[model samples]
Target: MSYHNPVLLQESIDALAIKEDGVYVDVTFGGGGHSREILKRLGPNGRLFAFDQDPDALENEIEDERFTLIPENFRFISRFLRFHRIKKVDGILADLGVSSHQFDEAERGFSIRFDGDLDMRMNQKSKVSAKEIINSYSEEKLAEILFLYGELRNSRNIAKTIVESREGERIETSFQLKQVLQKYLPKAKEHKILAQIFQAVRIEVNEELDVLREFLQQMPNLLKEEGRLSVISYHSLEDRLVKRFIRTGLFSGEPEKDVFGNSDVPLQKVGKLIVPTPQEIKINNRARSAKLRIATLKV
Candidate 1:
């Protein structure tokens, strides 16, 4: 059970400002760490609905009548909640980014330290694995993904190298891919660069950005009046989406003003952005990039 250490654990739960009997949702129940904390904060009658598309997470399901674990993706939050006869929840928590367990498990192919199959799907059944992305994507498309998702400046060259190497034989495993691009990874920055490269491939394989957008769009309808959304994102791309959506209700540009001359965003920021304390990060190195953003439905 070497799952994630739930970065900013107490802070995130406090962001929900939990009510004794309010309905809540943990949309990313990876290790069930956050969900277990939520259950502890709830009264006997309170309800918690958790979601995780990964089959591995199902083993950690909480044993309680008040808790329901939904074995599905959080992008389909609204639909699944409806099936459970829940229209509006008092609070929703999402911990974005890959779980620690995924990184630790070599076979999952989510870590740069491990040599494994290039299969980085969050859901095991996903059709597009990292192997397919590396082997099949056009150089231009690969460059785009690398630049946009990994923030790599030399994406064109990297993608070119991958394409050239794959022509001889499929880049089927993590080690094979690494060996192909070994020249690009100088000893000084090898780990950082490889992590970025793997990040780009993983994001595409899981359709993470698209999933985040879809889940955010459903928030206005899924939450009760004054309900809260407490999201913990591990990268700038995701943090920006949550921040922008909370501020303007749109991912890009500005939302039109309402009759009262105010922005029509459905959610308003609850407080300043929260990040892990140095002590917390010391305890869990993964918390280094973690950013927590809290918001509530507009009054």
Candidate 2:
């Protein structure tokens, strides 16, 4: 019922530049907050499709005939949308990262504040969970996830600590993992460091970065000419990928150019990056790290 207020709600919807009778997709309909707003802007003929892999999120489905909620991951956006007889949408909006509801439900095991099970599967049926990553992953692999996803510099030491500690007792819960890596979490930066560690494991369990990359790669072909894409990402990793793809049409390296020196990039940015105002952050702390980037199919 009370999912975190969708981060950058007004700004994100506005970025879509909605048309009264156009088709659109909300690829991360966690709470249906943005989907609701898009509906408000649509006329009788306008249609909106949404995607959410989490079983819990399906409970918040909208009843409107104009809206359809697809219970699948956005990484498969192309396949599912085609099933609905949709080829191109006028716009696509994505609110990336974990939702507040996921964090609040201690049983879901997303928050470090709660001493819950170490399961952080966005999709309840997911085979991998944070528990498996933390308790069963190789030390080298764990270090790689922590360093790359969490951006922790001392990842090797953290991985070593986890491997050593798990040898005595299996780390099955959030608090257990925290206790095992106690030395890495100093008093001043404990929360931040722990959050990063959790983030890394969660990302690995969910394959978040890979999912984002797949979703973005489909955008160029998914949207109609001049169709808009509005994405709100909560961290640097996601933001960087979105920024780079919109610029180069490729996740990494420079876009190849023709002999005439014109690079064939698919999307052009619509505006400067948008972030929450201090006022918005004051109202919802979750909005603090949100960054919005808007883009449209290049002419």
Candidate 3:
């Protein structure tokens, strides 16, 4: 199966306002779909640097002189770019969240549809995995992950159940986890609820929130003056951080004013938030929850 189908392709590419001779970065090159599009718009003088933490994505790397593929987490994007001797870029694009390929591959344990091992590390090299999170984390920690990341209403009860059930037997696989939480599963739309559970586990296992904060902090430093940043987030938690950072240069609250009473926001919102069109979502259901936001550096 294909690795992924890039969501909001045209919308995201257009948002970048690509310059033919400019440098660009695709922070999440899941399937190389977005990278290919960016490359097509670049002139021979232009360069494209793509980053993906998952080693699986490196298999799809395109052999182009103008393009460089970095198999590293995007949280270290700035450091990697500097190592390559590129100080700043004209534009940057990030399509956050799990790739369809990851979810579709049963072995990856990113989806609730398939019964597989609960190992949801985007970077397989990472020490942590979903199994560790489910079995090792305390009830309080588990409840917090489900409540904050999954936004599940019955997080406390679900966490309690998981803790009680895994007292003796180890919960290792997706099926086992699902069976343990069967009682909490919604009757009419059980799949959706299960998905949320899996999502929460995946987020915690990967430390996604922390990575997003690190990546966003590096964006202002990576982009040149007036350079554009187009980010597509699939969940409210991710979107809220992106929105807050872009609006106030802070992740959660207003920017602190200097002694001169001037705020130091590094980015300026380019336009209102953009979402996939009905037509686009009709073809790709994964695009339904996507929210795209564009920002430009203040110089």
Of the two candidates 1 and 3, the one with more favorable TM-score, higher being better, is: 1
Instruction: State the lDDT of candidate 2 residue by residue for 1-299, as single tens digits.
Output: 38858888999999999999999999999989999999999999999999999998999999999999999999999899999999999999999969889999998999999999999999989888888888898999999999999999999999999999999989999889888888878899999999999888888989999999999999999999989999999999999999999999998789989999999999999989999999999998989999999999998
Q: How would you encode candidate 3's per-residue C-alpha lDDT over 1-299 as one tens digit per residue?
A: 27898988888899899999999999999999999999999999999999998988999999999999999999889889999999999999999969999989999988888998999999999999999999999999999999999999999999999999999799999999999988877689788889889889888888898999999898888889879999999999999999999989897657889899989899999989999899988988989999999999996
As for lDDT, the candidate ahead, 1 or 3, is 1
**Clashing residue pairs in candidate 1, if any?**
none
Greater TM-score among 1 and 2 belongs to 2
How do the residues 2-56 of candidate 1 rate in per-residue lDDT, one tens digit apiece? 7878888999999999998999999999998999999999999899999999998
Better of 2 and 3 by TM-score: 2
Q: Give TM-scores for every candidate, taking all chains together and pairing residue i with residue i.
A: 0.98, 0.99, 0.97
Clashes of each: 0, 0, 0
Each model's lDDT: 0.93, 0.93, 0.91
RMSD of each: 1.0, 0.8, 1.4
Worst 10 residues of 1 by lDDT: 1-10
lDDT of 1: 0.93
